[model samples]
Target: MIRFVPADVGTIGQKRKQVSRACNGCRAKKKRCRHVEASPKDLDSQIQAAQLAKGDDRIDAINDDYATSPTADSSTIPASTRPSLQVSPSENTRNPVCQSTMAAPPQDTLAPRFVDGLNPEGVFLAVHSPQDTRGAFSHDRVGIWLADKLNSKEKQNDRTLTRSWPQSSLLAGRHSLLPPHESIRNLTSIYFKRFHPILPIINESAFRSLGPTDPAYILLQQGICLVASMIPSSKGHLFLGDSEVPLQHREFGKRVVSAMRISTEAGVITDKIVLIQALVLMWMFSDGPDARDVSSLLCARVVQHIQSLGFHVYRKSPDQASHYESTMLCCVWAIDRLNATFHGRPVLMHERDFGIDLAVYIDSQMPCTRLFLHVISWLDKVIDMYRPNAELRSSDLEIPFDSFEDLLVQSQSLRIPTPLLGQFIILISLPRAVFSLSRIWLIFSPKATIETLYHAVSILSCRPRSFNTKILSSASRSRRELSAERVTSLVLDKQVCQLTYFPFVPYAVSLSLSVAYSEMRHTKVPMLRARARDKLQINCGLLERLGEIFYLAGLMSDMGKSTLDEYDRIYLTAVEDYQQNYSGSCAALDSIRATERVEIIDNSNAVPSTSREFESNNGVNGHSLLTQESDPSFYVDLPDLDVFGLFDPNFNLDGIDAYLEGNLNLTYPTNF
Candidate 1:
């Protein structure tokens, strides 16, 4: 969840301290207590001085520290409540020092002073004690109310809020004259009604200066409107599967996308980031087939724009990494949906036939696997928007092995390793994307249309291979078996590996799946159509392998569901350990767990352990020892090292396309 910390926390703290001094001031005034020289009343001059510097925004200043200190001694008061203070110019003119040293006032000093029309005393009191204006509510009560109002405003400001005013007097009288709905009321009404709202807070004059319809402004406004349309944080229907906390702001990002419609080579505007954030929001809450469509389009657009700007290389990569994160992950997510619905294939990058020709194109590129995993995670999160019951599953989202061969071909045989971090990320992500897309597809597709089903399946069949090994290694096992084993491995590794590093293994898994799936369905054959689009018959063997890959990927994704829970356990353990330190309890258990987690991270680093004797006998230099230690640790633990971590899932293990994952065949054409 995105966190918002007030930038002026220190200021707020200081202000809070000032608010706490009122009692001290009162005690000094009553002469009953002269212990504290720096009373709350003493701070008022400082606050007033700061206010003067900020211009005449007295309302804000008044609201800022209206609350009285809670630690006041009310016991000395008579059984009857104290009368409220009256405001008047005379009250303000009263000697500041004298007021501080005077006997106890009979009322809440800050209360608005009431007056008879002609009474000088009453008028003086009324003008000086503005707190009394709120009537009946004490200074503290008023402060609490204002704080709530400020909080609500803060929440509204976080989103892109917009308003439209009626131009004519007749319309203004009917709508504009009506008391505005409370912010919470407006937000909740829209969420339940599924309609849009235009709760503009800014005056219409400022808006007009922005133009009748600047795409940027529209985009900004749209983003705000979406935020406004969300359920008032505290009103979510938890029984209906809504887990959003009450009154806490949740970004309804999907709704913001409707405002984005830029189509140019001009440099991206800040609005584009807002648009990307919206897409990310969609990926979080609305992962369905439709969501995939939108996500895919966004990805394609971002990539094309970046490429056009000659930002294909890491050096040329856009400074805005977050946007790229959305695009790359979106592509992975889109394809995962296709895989799930079609039961067909992964569509990873390495599976492309571009020929492994790394060159500068390799820089800053997320490994296909890692990118795919993130996309799937995004998709899975959004799936709840369409299908509450839907959850991510890894076994059902595997990438075929043949796709890795495709990557090799694209890179011209760069010989990239199989099931590396790149592959793992792809594997973990696929299921979520698939689940999200499936939920969406079921909603909008014609209820009984074979064409829709065919379309979904076809798209699934076209997905890229996440791993080269889908083509490089032959499992000789059923899809179910592959899933079981992969899941077991994931759980086991997470338990044994360093928790901090272990989480990253999912990245490798995602990469492998993306590569493996990309290859099975090759771009030459359109997978979505019911009729044959390719001259060649569908490769039955390849299709079956791809299906198995998908299933396995789904299983892996399923395991990811426990990631947060596991993280919480670790977090709690750490917290407990911290508290125990103060209590003088030994933290041996925590130390052991922490050590184990570190070792796992080392293992994932793929380092090898050499006995001290062997190292000395081999006469390896410290540098070589260090390098070896940094290598993947497959040799240390896996007895079946030959097959256990072999073969890049991004390559075709079956060699259907006959290419290595990273062979880098330079002769391949620049365009190819």
Candidate 2:
């Protein structure tokens, strides 16, 4: 030191030792060691800073350099070689401070530190910041260097965790079950083109924006695929190509189950539009063994959900809703109302609850949609009016009849595009048939008494009578009065029949034929009577043809046969009674004539006196001498002529109220 030796003038080994002994912070800055002479306070602060910079290479080097530093106070050396130091409390202690001036030790010398105050128990501890406990990487420049290695370890741990806890249920594992994008697109196209016109529950633009991975979209797609696969090949050709594949029943069922589970688990039923769309599609496409019953149960579930969600009471304000949403609400309500009617169940909502006006909807350019909504609304009105306690009068029927005729006229006037022709026919004709049936129901309700029956018969028989003016004035004017002749003619008209081909036609035709036959049996006019019989035969032939077209009609055909057989039994009884009365009268007249001839021959001389005696022997009036030619009660005494058995003791025509109050069994079709 007195000679002032250069600090860099050490041997090769000595230089390497000096470099190794340097604190990492000084080495990193390429400066001489300064922390070696740092006071305890400075050292503690440096230690904390190092811990905060957990993965810094400088922290390890600082720990190593402190362990090998020769002197606790390097201030004696030249200021150029050693940085300045601050004094700490440890300098005042009497204990000898530990010092290290030796050359760097071998690799074995590197170990965790056990410093006083930092590790009082003499156990080695690695100092690190709280952030370091989470990971050994950082976003700083130095951290970028460590991220690659740390990220690799993290990925491995994630893989291990996934393997340890695997998803077990289909819903929990639906991500892998999503169909290919191409398949989804194809099915969606088929659905939009074929089913949407009929249902129109989904908004195409909004649905497309949700993308394929959305859970609700997945459910809708699965339903669509199921529906598409079930469509007959002939119908499929209208939407999809021959090369397009179809899903198997098992696959379709699994998808449906998975979609339902996902929706339930995710609690998406709260989303009214999605839930309604899915439910409506499911209701429409449901088919298999017992499909109608299953679908009906499903419809009930939908109604319950709708009520729970307050959809039945939801009103659309023009400023608050999009056109699509309003249209969808209308469509869903229509579907629900129509399905309830078809199943003979109570409607979940009433027409008055709806804020959307049918009159407004009817004026919209979408004729098919307007017609569909109009028909369902009319049906709802029919249900309300037909209830047991409803204050229904003949005037109440006028609105429905007027609305029905208006809808039919509007439907006929519209030049429907060719693509919608099939749906247009179904939508238009189904309501037309139901309207015809409702008219029949109104005329023959359980309230109908003997006089009403006679009046109805007279109208159905198309006989001109004074009663016609009284009855026809109250009932609304239709395209034609609801009569047996009109119904039969409608069923037999080649064009109209072809347009309205469905199971309902056969049902209406059968009921009308029964009514005609009942009225015919009591008709005194031979010409009208024969005409009724011919019309009955013609309608029966039409029913046979309808049965061939619709399998459900076969069941209705059996019901028609039972009705006709009952009519025949009553007619034969009445005819036999009339013939017996005629024979007895003829025999009485012959006896009277024989007695008269005998009296005339025996009293030939007193012929004038005998004639006077015969005239006087008769009652006060000559009319009393003849047998009464007419029996007013002849037809009235015949069996209660319920040709359709609608008013039979086994059935209840008490109306919709009875039906809603758990007497639904009475509403089931006899053949069903």
Candidate 3:
């Protein structure tokens, strides 16, 4: 097998040029024959030339080649220095991008794009001092730079504002976002059963007493109905047909927004507790995979409310709300940790900031809630252990008790609720999925060869020692396959069902789907590929199921399928290269196996394709997942690109790279 190393930008014999070699005048006396730098047309030719060259392992550096594409703006402002958060007031006022961004939204494609939270539209990357190189000093800067780089590849992908949820739906004459009065009772019941246990913010008795008439309870009731509508079976549909469900959802959403505004912005705080609960419940509505989401806003207000109420520093008191406050504080901290991890922001509500004794309350809670706390507690430690931007290395995943297996044991002993358990399967499997993505990163990084990635992806099918000496020798323990097996088993054990309804579930499902894509696309062994294909179908079903209610999941599903289709088209080209290489006649293209396309098998429930011929060809006993042959014909083939996606573990980098190019048929110039 040839080691396949794709240069970021290259043509067969041509090196990618930031500046053309012939810088001098070629039309004039032809003195030096210097190469002139590429125009947009030249860059396109250079990439096409690299594709036709059909050679691999041309360059070792991380992919750096990009030019102003037809989609990208022709000009950029050069960076004189990096901006700091603590800049003086005068300097901040002088920055027009900040003022313009907030005061008026740009309607054109040339509007600035935000990197991290700040706009990097007009800035060029500045050279760092000797001590401040890439991936040094601050992991955050490295992440921001990577984001800027990928965003440059997708400058024109921003959707027009009109494509979002209709403003008329929310702002139209006095239409409340809530369901009908009778429907409210049903939705409230659904919310308590489906969302309340996990969230534990709202008090059941207060809602019963206030009965949606009071301003405080009104907002709280609206929030409950808004989130509950995500349940396809929640019966908040207002007797409108299924086509009207989204409209019904928007109405509920409208009611929640109106109720919150009137209570908080328009009048005095009526009841602090009710207000906080409503804010917390509304947090799920801030992000949508497919729509324009206010992802960075709601969490901050929720944090402020918690701190303002002194929930962060409360001691058990004679007050009737003391117990509720304690539980709510713990929930806030846990959710804060999740938001920090999910959004790549700093943790706003840290454990150190809390004055409450959380463990006592956690221990006294229901088993399911207790299990949720325990899971989140371990996650906090993991987040602390690694910078959200640092790539996982071979040695990094040897998680010290707290190994994922321990969490599994704890969950089983506690009898975690089935829905939360489904969420847990998604949650605990996260580190491994992220670790697996990190494995893919090794393929591009200077650390390892592409073959190592193949071995890592096939961990679920391989024996413990099969690749340990080559791949895991650096780590103290071999945990790669064990983690993979656990993920497979957890998903296989349960029927596909709705995970706890929240913004995070669809996003997590998206991440898991990306891992399946890595395995499906990169595995060299046929049986492993087949197994991966099966997993892809299951995850796709899961994502689509969630997509029905969550706009983000639906957006992700469409994006994943489109990207896979693009990769499959490219794969056929590589397959031709692979066939030629093995023929011993075409060495230039042999290493690029187009036949190794992104496989999207039809269903997960189909019987495994195990046959005596397959076992013999792969030289494995019937039990081993193998097909000794590398021939494309040996296994079933997919005629179309069914689905493919990437959820990078570097959560900070997740929103960029994979998703920036989403919704468009954009392709990285390097890979064929």
Predicted model with the maximum lDDT: 3
lDDT ranking from best candidate downward:
3, 2, 1
lDDT per residue for candidate 3 within 116-189, as digits (tens), equals: 32344323332322221223224333222222333444433433233222333333322354556667778777
Off by over 4 Å in 3: 1-175, 235-264, 267-270, 287-293, 317-321, 388-397, 401-498, 521-527, 570-672
Q: Number of the top candidate by TM-score?
A: 3
| Per-model TM against the reference | 0.22, 0.41, 0.50
List, residue by residue over 166-227, the lDDT tens digit for candidate 1: 11222222222111235334443443222111111222233336642354344334433443
Task: For candidate 2, report its TM-score.
Answer: 0.41
Please tell me which model should have the higher lDDT, number 2 or number 3: 3
Candidate 3 matches the true fold with a TM-score of 0.50
Per-residue lDDT over 3-93 for candidate 2, one digit per residue giving the tens place of the 0 to 100 score: 5533432222243533225778888999878554544554454443334334435544654444333212222222332112233346323
> What value of lDDT does candidate 1 attain over all alpha carbons?
0.31
Q: Which stretches of candidate 2 lie over 4 Å from their true place?
A: 1-195, 206-272, 282-296, 307-315, 351-365, 391-400, 403-405, 408-552, 561-672
Which one wins by lDDT: 1 or 2? 2
Q: Alpha carbon lDDT of residue 467, candidate 3?
A: 26
Cα lDDT of all candidates, in order? 0.31, 0.45, 0.47
Worst 10-residue lDDT window for candidate 2 reads 441-450
